[model samples]
Target: MNEFLIKSGIAKGEGNWYSRLTSSLYERIVWQKLNNPLGYIALALPSLLIAYIVSKMGFAIGVVILALIIGLPLTFAAMFYLKFGISLIIVLSFFLLGVKRFVGDVQLGLLMDFLIAVMIFGLIVRQVQERDWSFANNPISKIILVWVIYNLLQGGNPSAESFLAWVYTVRSFAGIMAMYFLLVYAIRSEKDIYFLIKVWIGLTLLGTIWGYVQEHIGFLPFEMAWIMATPERYALLFQAGTFRKFSFFSDPLVYGILLAFTSLLCFVLATGPFSKPKKIFLLAAGMFMMVGMLYSGTRAAFILPVAGLLFYGILTLKKQVIIAMFFAALVLGVVANVPSSNPNIVRLQSAFNPTEDASYKVRMRNQAFIRPFIYTHPLGGGLGSVGEWGKKFSPWSPLANFPPDSGFVRIAVEGGWLGLLIYSALLYTVFHVGIKNYLLLKNPKLKVVSLGMLLVLFSLTLANYPQEAIGQYPISLLFFVAIAILNLSVKFDRKPELLHA
Candidate 1:
């Protein structure tokens, strides 16, 4: 019976009759035209006519028509090609919120949610067709599942101030996390990994260049308008007699921390068995990123690379690594001590002297005040009881106004001490998996990539303590991708020949 169904094209798979019908129509209508020069003229005439008509209608109508003409097919293509979807997620993370400067207060995050959902649906379709889910059955994936489950269960917490807040927060916490499985499933080859890394580094270089422009030249008119839209935002961004450059990210903290961690990845990758020109490029990019971090004026960003390198050095336990660490430390020490009037340098120095900073002291006080509540409630005030959701949905609640400055603190406040413990275990498992893979991998290239990934993970983990490093837009997405890549590195080690291929 099964064989008969398969042969008859009645099976519930990609080779079914419905799929064949769609494929035939798509080929005849789209592919043939796209592939043939004569077909191009046939298609372009109608498209040009529609474009002319849309232009006559009005600007907004024309824009909508243009978007539909482009976006619909691209969306369908992304759904079909999970790699393209994943790549879109990565690219958008860098510039999605930045779009607010041009478009005004649109709910762009919903678009991200839609993209992730599409990717997950694509994964499901692939799994159904292939009958294989083993790629996503790794330790990192399991822990992410556990974390998502915990966050989902938060909606039922009786102490939760608003179910709507849970609805909002869980979209990010549980919904966005599904990307981890999608990424793990999609990244099946070494080439795919390298392509994604190139995308990441290329975007980072652009961000750094924009940041340099902002520092030396100035904010473009639209960016200035966006900055001045809110007085609080203006005050926060404009510090120490100059505006802190955020590049393409939402804020300086996100921009600076991203650069700090990715620069560590760059430097680590340069140490791989690659060609001299590639190594030089990696080193140059890493230096550019570090310089960009300085321009961000985010004190939390300053310590991350140092800590990441120290972790890497200890893990390697090589004489040369020790020597390198010594020189890096000496440079940092001189920079910290040889005080300059430059605000960027002063901010850098303050990162090392956290106790002396007014903001640091305030954060400490807030944590102390919030600690007793965490101790009292096993599940704390519940998810979304603090931070942006709290302010939006439960403005009257005391916790609503509370600033859980650190990611850990936010977790503790929302999920309580028990939740914090679970979150911590997840972090520990990621590190354990990454370190185990790095130590066990035999291929030199795989080892280098795995080590670079692990160091970036370590840096983000540490940064989460001082800033909400892993919870923001691109950073959060990148954090999961890094873990997926860490697990993937080990998988690639089994097929070392593929590295060259």
Candidate 2:
């Protein structure tokens, strides 16, 4: 079994520590040999001194200071060696960001930006040190790079109310693009791809459990306080529903859309060439996430999951999956219409019947209001002109007060019709390429992973028509990660899953 594990690269060679040197600089310089009193004393002097100093300071402050002094460098080192450290930080920010926002003014996304900046610095240093300078300088990266440059140009626009606003918008949007390229350039093999997919879905599952608990049971004190604080937002809930399971995302809509995507992906993966136990686990997780998604009361997101499932079937060239998916949907519909149907069915039915929906009416009005400005100012009001970004940054701007209502409209308000076209073109380009590659890629596993990502992207895009899905945390991070994975998958024809060293 040890031999098998070693062959599989699961077991690694190690130093049986304490006696046999793990070969640290201190091990040779101070230790000289295990339990040598003089060497031990020399090694212990700095730590012992720090402990004394800590005893003088309060324990908490001293520990914090010590962590900052020591832990930061260690974290940065891990970011380089593990290569997924930045990705994990980005993921964690997604998981905790909404909760952080509930607390106060310290922007959680800014922390993500800070970590990425450090990651970029460390990545540059590592690449230079190793003299290994290969990058995924493909069309997608180039397009994203150009888009970043375009956002940078927004910083100099005369219309921008606050320089900080422009800076934040450029950094937020362009940073997501940078993240795409970073993941693209960093991903080495199928192993990395699998690790990323698992982590992404693992977080989704965790979020589903949280959201389910929030609805079926109750929220934590902080969450309840935040929910109570915003009485006005209750009207904003889908159909003015009493409770919506937002989980760790920015809102119920975002959470529901993400759950829809992840739920579909889990179900698809369950049917793959996996062990029976793994398949069963995936199936159960998918169902649990689905229940959480239903609790979100996000009618707009409901339709997209079906679209994703259909895309999955088409992409995989599995007619049976399509037939089964339709059958499942039919059964769900029948069950939904039963005499004792779930209240969720009534809420979701409103998705297809939105004529009287208050939110839908408001959205229509918003679209009408934004159209004239979009047509007149074809270039745009600027990046932060409308939506939450607008209110926080350009509160004085008239456009800032009015909601943009849709991601598509928000793009139009910020970047103009031309900008929306360009953005849409970029997305379609990736989608087309992913579809083409799904058919062309020789490796079935690569095909499955990349295709699943494309479907998720597709679902998110559809969901974005009603809400800004991509720019939000976790979604943005995960979306770009998928794009990067798809970009890297293009290389499979030339090289297999193995790393180049």
Candidate 3:
């Protein structure tokens, strides 16, 4: 068995950690079990129990068991490898909620929280071995720490209506922030950043393709079933005589914002120091993503890329940027004027003409009404005092029925005006550092990459004004990762040796 492990390259050398661990595991599990009757019975018991359960419960239970068996290796891989874990979390974020379409009601979203917790543990173990923590010593890390502390303090908010609501909401509030520090610590080289960007862009392209299919072909049967399961959902989605395209995300809002911001990122990266083939692909992907964003029928999404472009143009102040912005404005003007009864086009046009939108007016009214309550409550209503948490945990409260449509509004209501002030400071610092980093970077490629991330962040920031943008799964995860990259790009620029650090 030891010889086989060495031959198979599982054990690099005789006295290494891998060799001893694998050799010991093999001997104890296979060799010792074979020589002892009780050991053989112990191994057989698992198979016998599995067979009995299958026989009694049927194929579904057997299938579940098989899935768990398969998932065990994947889970362990994530636990041991930080990069693999981050990539897995991002991939799962894209489809975790969508899985409910086929699987029925289940706490699948919690899987993200679980993965984050495991990765945090893995990070701690790795830190113990390495004994170096300087990677996270940056302004980005400091602000994120401040944000996490504030969220955790929400549990003690005297005005909090329900402690249970805090429990449910704080997981995302303070918990997912762990990924930022993990990423800052784990990312040692430019290649790591490239790998992460590739994973993000590749999955985003797949989502764009899926959204296109749902727009032209139609949703899958299960997706349709999921949409029609609730009347309010069906009504919300089935807009303008067609259902909005959510792709693999939880809702059209999340899907559209993702496509919009990622498309902006792609377009910005196209101008980076890359081969012509890569540039062409980025341009093509950006177009497809724009199409997907339009199909989502989300007015908020319609403005994100436009906002991103404006931000990019301001930061660069180049002739190419001026030309790009002109063309963008021209294209949007044409779309707004081209007399089209199509709902998607109409929705896109309406984004530019917000004053005419009834929903926009309603959102404004809600924000106005909530302004007084937010001002009175310094700590806000607590993390989960609004949205579904409020509806479930404190249904009788006025805030329960109130709809905080925007991310900023939700934060203001839940965290209070003071919390909102701190959150806003965090946002301001992110952009302040991001812009400063982008300006200081002398490397062209690093500059473009930093600019791309900043633009994406800018789009998300704009999106939060109309939708709960960064509070969702993939967006929240990706947002922190982008910040980490942006903060590190300047370091890479300053010392090229850090590119391979």
Candidate 4:
């Protein structure tokens, strides 16, 4: 039998073409087994365990023990399951629950749910696939991996405090991944994209109405009780006798971000791809989104829509609008910087001047205080080591008071300057690819979409300097999808006409 096998080429160098082919096929099967289903499962297990443990423990000592038990498995899993949807349901469930629980005192529960969703999604993706795995292959799956890797490398420690911080990072990553997957995978063609955009527009309109009610009617649904419970947090909006909008999201910031993005999408559809009726509808949606943005009172959120319009104008035949928007931006900047006797106007003015601004000074002071430790721990204070994580892990550290405000700073503090550089490079690459594709693509609609996406990234980059918006779910997922879509669109440059709506 051994001689026959050797002679057959399946054994060594012996046999015919058939034997060689069989050997090749066998090798392929083995490789596939190592790379596919089995490998995927192995990588996802640790993240699953981490998700479960963190859900129960709130990133306490239990997470450390769990990480210790499953760390190697997680490492292996990260290598294999690079694009799986292991955490979709978990995150959606958490977000839905958060929406429901926001009315009550379940902020912690909301936080836990969000974290669990993020952890599961992030780890499974990291462990399973190769680095090149992306949305064209499976936008949702690849984004999940991105989220996991981002959260995992965020800090060094595997302790409870770090774990809790990980939860937030993970949730943000997972949520956005879910949305992108739903958008790209479920929506097969342009019509589907249109339908989904309409749905989003409708949702935004409804959310605006709901927000108005919350502000005016004194009717608090069970879903929004948590916001009501946090009187201190909600008091400013409520007391101002202005509309305190929540827009089917957890907070004004989140609501404003979603509204801004959706509005930009509407603007893209209006100006680039659709029929006249569609454009009209989109215009209406854009108007509503603008209203939502204003009511949400997120000054930072204002930049996205305005920036998107500027980009759209620059790219399209809207030269007059482009010039108008440029002057408008300049005027706004000037007005926002003008010191005035009016307190509200002065406050708005100060927002444009980060140097003398109270909030800017606070951020700078925090950065100053944390610089020494960051210098010493160049590899990062260790995952979840400072700020919120530090408060949980190393409460003694002087840097604990520095909230993880900036996503860039968060990465710098956790992974050190090296990690921040990598992140920055990745972001730059996204913008670069987006701009190149936008300029090259013949499809006017896609070009607008690409531009809008680029604006999202640019806005997030700016926002991250003052706040931790980049890693948050939905936003992060959107960022990656935008990048992926732009990257995929680049392939059509030679045949731009083929990509037109």
Ranking 3 against 4 by lDDT, winner? 3
TM-score, cand. 2 vs. native = 0.84
Model 3 C-alpha lDDT per residue in residues 186-285, reported as the tens digit of each score: 7777888888999999999988889989988998889988998889999999988988999988899888999999998999999999999999999999
lDDT of candidate 4 over 255-372, digit per residue (tens)? 6666777677776657666578878988887887776666666656666666666666766657777787879788887777666664434434544555775656777887887777
TM-score of each: 0.90, 0.84, 0.90, 0.64
Off by over 4 Å in 4: 1-200, 218-225, 228-244, 309-318, 326-350, 353-356, 386-389, 491-501
Candidate 1: which pairs clash?
Answer: none
> lDDT per model, in order?
0.86, 0.74, 0.87, 0.58
By summed lDDT, the worst window of 10 consecutive residues in model 3 runs over 5-14
Which one wins by TM-score: 1 or 4? 1
- Please identify model 3 stretches exceeding 4 Å from their true place: 1-51, 498-501
Deviation in Å, model 1, residue 18 alpha carbon: 22
Cα error of candidate 3 at position 207, Å: 0.9
Backbone collision tally, model 2? 0
